[model samples]
Target: MTDTVADVTPEIAPSSYDAAQRRSDAIWQKIESDPSGLRMLTGDRPTGALHIGHYFGSLRNRVRLQQAGVETWVIVADYQVITDREILGDIQGSVRELLTDYLAVGIDPERATIFTHSAVPALNQLMLPFLSLVTQPELERNPTVKAELAAAGKSAMGGLMLTYPVHQAADILFCHGNLVPVGKDQLPHIEQTRVIARRFNERYAGGEEYFPEPDALLSESPTILGLDGENKMSKSLGNTVMLRMDEAETLKKIKKAKTDADRQITYDPEDRPEVANLLTIAAQSTGRTPEDIAEEIGDRGAGTLKIFTAEALNAHLAPLRARRAELEQDPGYLMQVLRTGNERANAEADETLQRVREFMGMVY
Candidate 1:
């Protein structure tokens, strides 16, 4: 939601969009019929605790993929976190706590592999050759990278930030991922990953296809903005509904969230971002449409809307919060989950790295 969408004045190809639509449609058409499932790569940066946004936007999809028998990889993107922050802060602490939330949210450790970025040294080994495949301008042109830097008020882009797309390419290619479940903001990253895969296969495969060009499987997730309605829900922005927030705290934050003076509940996203955001939260949590929620409220005022929204969010998050707490109490068990996942991830990544070495004639 916070991503800065670039102007598409130059990309005015009708056939290109037509082709893309067909490809995207084909991917979803057999999602249920196909039992083999996809090899998916997705996760969060361990900057802080995840919130409702993370749950709906990503974690929910991760759980679904795991249940569908997909080979899912959940990355604690610790390496990407350092690109923005000057200090490491409490990264290990954040990773441990977040892993608990991941498990509590239903990403079964047995099905989905979870690992930190730095822990997978095999991923780092692909960086050099992958970097060679991409041009500097392509790196600079990544819309997500530009948006992240601008949002953070950063004037100069760090080397890591500039090359983050390349790092992402490494992340996906290392695992031989074919489907990346992501929000609309992250589509471009997957497209970049495709480009990398194509380049590597062509250059090294000697007329054979070695890598599967990954496709973006966009989630049908409503864009959940922050309480301020001015930015995406972010823990650092102090405007997130934390996944672990107690009932009282969650209600308190919703009560203070921005709403208009119109008093009537309408899902107007453009003019009333705040009201639209609240409606989105309630509707998604309660399994109803925003229009339905608004119609039921029927001019009951923003107060009623806020209460309904908060209660719905609380109802949804209660079990999850409790589960996270229980997991947190048993650190040894949670650590075991992560360790097992890390081993799985390392083995997969190492296998891919060895293949790349053999293809490049470095296996002497």
Candidate 2:
């Protein structure tokens, strides 16, 4: 176990963003040219049903990468559910729902590997060696770990909470995943994973590269603010529209979303954030600019804006919702897909573990 934080560290290393962005751009080109050369690991904790924020945030990018021929591994991260939460709320159901959401968003089982954390023992075994590579201070200083701990509202954190970043490193290296899709806030976690990979190679692999220093694939999508128009859209905040919501439900949520009293709708994000947020949602759905959308809805109050945003969002989600409905009818297929993924991941993790053991001269 590790101790709690008495002080804060820089959330992200100041100079790393430019370098990360440069590498990300170059990696994007490589992916476009030869996607088969790269393996990407990206996923969500089974906290709850995904919302439109998730859809635009990362799920859409995952679908794009899968379609682009990148080898993708989507981990359910079921074990991570315990890192912050005290009560294990319906995790089993959340796992199933996450699978459905992935498939519903076009993550083809045939193209991507989707597995849960607890299913692969060999992968978790990598944690022991990886943990040894870093000092306790390193773990304590990790910005992601600190932020997560603060979010959980705990004055002191457990070992799992403190070492969450290391576990993530194992998740990537266990499968030798080279690219991780993330937002800027998550870059520090990727940096920590890279450190673990480099350290392991130096210490046990005799300065030979055993694990690839995974690069952060930052999301280019604009941040999707919650309906409150104040914070990022999150399920925990109760300010997001779930992907499974019907048209009526979506409309109800959107109608209740916050917007300013300005009679003439505009797209000035700095000054008119609330109204601009609604416009952004409408723009993303209808494939138009927020400015253009606002112009079309000129002089319309929040009531009309809400209706327009809801209609556009619903229309965009109509196909996905229909696919989800069909999938809901056959629960067995979803479970089978997970079982198959788990088998494949276990095989991969086993091979990686064997190599790690050999590298450290623990093969006897």
Candidate 3:
């Protein structure tokens, strides 16, 4: 598998394409042939600041994958923000912020393309044709759709909300992505993408594979509970600790977080959720087991636990915070990174779209 995009020199290269085009083709070929090489597609809806939940849950894994030489594409799911529609006013800012967060977390723009959904119209258009491949029953059975509906407190759901897994399928298949880093709850989305890929190939192009069946790259980190300690960490609930928070702010949040009032700390998640959550966070930050951390801090009250957790978390995040500040100081540089990434993403997406059109007999 090719680790770097092929060099394209204009005088000797094909007159019809530029360096980016040549590089994209090289990447596509590598993805097709390499067994261990991963073409990853994963993203978050651009609603607000990325919190610890996103970092531990997905971004951490992404950094590891990229450093290991995977060709990664991080999408800013800006279009999906319209599912609720109330947050539309800030989508543009949210997209920029997400890019910032990606860079801050060590996702190299040179190594991975970080792009916004709005920038990839061809990919989004594929959703319409792709939607026809799956049935209503399949869509209705998707756990993510059900969870979203329940969260919204609605008996009825929007078409987009119901068929989101298809849209997700489009995100991966459009990129010809072969691996998706996701949590357990999102396993169903990966399953749906695989089904859609098979269905599309079987229907449009027989006897050969057109799309790769994307596999899940499961995260090893514990499910990060919100500071509330009752639900998944989320920005909307204001229960999250932002990735860019200062040391003082991070310490304050952890110090004030809810924990079991019991005098001794242990790692029983079922009976002592709040204290267990603290232990999990401590363990994740330190690369130790929750029990080991609890034992090490034996007989320590929740105050000592919170302080220790805060120190560990701050140590881990300090460098990220510093990098974020440096990146944030230069908006032009950040925009250029995203713009270059989007260009690379569009080049690859356009090639796949062309193949899809040809397979479906839409070629002119």
Per-candidate clash tally? 0, 0, 0
* Tens digits of lDDT, candidate 2, 156-265: 97999888888988989999999998887877778989999999999899999879999998788877889999887877678899999999999999999998888898
Model 1 spans with C-alpha error above 4 angstroms: 1-21
Q: 199-245 in candidate 3: lDDT tens per residue? A: 88899879478898877665556787888788877666777889989
Per the 3 Å backbone cut-off, how many clashing residue pairs does candidate 1 have?
0
What C-alpha lDDT, on a 0 to 100 scale, does residue 271 get in candidate 3?
Answer: 91
lDDT by residue for model 1 over 1-364, one digit each (tens)? Answer: 1112221112214564455556656777766668374688887777667788878877887787677777788888888777777888899898987898898899888777889888889998888889988998998887777877776688999898888878888888788888777655666676788888899989987857788888777677787888998787867678988898899999999999988898788888999999999999998899999989998997899999999999999998888988988998999998888788789889988998899999899997
lDDT of 3 at 160: 79
Rank candidates, TM-score, best first: 2, 1, 3
Worst 10 residues of 1 by lDDT: 1-10
Cα deviation at 247, candidate 1, in Å, is 0.3
RMSD for each model, in Å, please?
3.0, 3.2, 10.8
Q: Give the worst 10-residue stretch by lDDT in candidate 2.
A: 1-10
Instruction: After superposing candidate 3 on the true structure, give the runs of residues whose Cα lies further than 4 Å from its correct spot.
Output: 1-35
The candidate, 2 or 3, that scores higher on TM-score is 2
